[model samples]
Target: MSGVAKVVAFMQRSWWRAALVFAVLAVAFVVFGRYAVPPSTALTSGALALELVGTRSGAVAVLRAFEQQHSVHAAWVSITWDFAFIASYVAVLVLALRYFARPGEPDLIDRTAAKSAVLAGAADCLENLGMLAMLAASPQQPPDWLGFAAFATTVASLVKWVLAAFAAGHALWLAWRKLAQR
Candidate 1:
């Protein structure tokens, strides 16, 4: 078979894995909606870290505040998590478009591959946000307020690690391109 035909067949076979991702995301979304949980309030490391720290800074005060406003506030926490998803989604989609379309190739558009990649990335984001949110919103917590300070610190470190990976990836990509041009 020709090169193009071979690639097309490969994608068709692999498409099932991609569909499964979206199906899982839909289930998670339904669960989150039922719980009346916004993704940001539930997920997003930075925001959860903030709440953890804030709760620690003055536990009585934090409890008092949460009790007072938790009932009154709109479901805006999801908005924060939603923003994070958009950012990650765009980055992943850009990377996917580059890979599938392979701009240097004669065909400028690999429409099926490009579209599939974006859908997969979005599903990944939703799943991640859902997982994090569920963790943050869990009923169980340390009996002592001070322990949550430690939780905040741990989350901050994880966020740092995530950022470092992205920065390293970007630097490497740039360096590779520069050397290739030489």
Candidate 2:
């Protein structure tokens, strides 16, 4: 078998390991996300707000809010941690899909769903990069690129969410079908 096929086979057999890593990453993500919340903002609200900020003005507003609450550093910390979370989630989702795939030739839907998970992770990474760029810029004297960054970030975030939801939903459907057959 090709190296890629071999790796996929290995991952299909190691879904539990990916799941355990995902659980750890999820808890860490939550803890860091909580820390990212500004005093004036609701719990984990800042993170979501940052992700959805589609304009330079919106990005500045969110950044200023975090600055006022002295949580800008915390926000950065949380976003950095999110990189690891993205990897864990993508791995677990892909592995789960592979594990549940039917025997013999791979189903096109299963392959597409697995690819979606990877794409979602890539989009998430882009979103995080854009956010990081915005965070590094001063709210009062924001860079000329801030607007483009904000727009791109929002786009990436939306794509990430949509693809992830599709992948997760497909995985659940596959699981249900498999269980029903038993």
Best by TM-score: 2
lDDT of 1 at 26: 52
lDDT tens digits by residue: candidate 1, 82-125? 44454444344433333333335424234434444344444434
lDDT score for candidate 2 against the true structure: 0.80
Instruction: List clashing residue pairs in candidate 1.
Output: 39-78, 42-133, 43-133
In model 1, state the lDDT of residue 6: 48
lDDT per residue for candidate 2 within 1-182, as digits (tens), equals 86445655655566675466457657765664454443445216777888899999999998888888787777788788778778767866776676667877768999999999999999999999998898898999989999999999999999999999999999888878877998
TM-score of every candidate:
0.31, 0.82
Task: Provide the clashing-pair count of each candidate structure.
Answer: 3, 0
Model 2 residue 62 distance off true place after TM-score fit, in angstroms: 0.6
lDDT score for residue 116 of model 2: 99
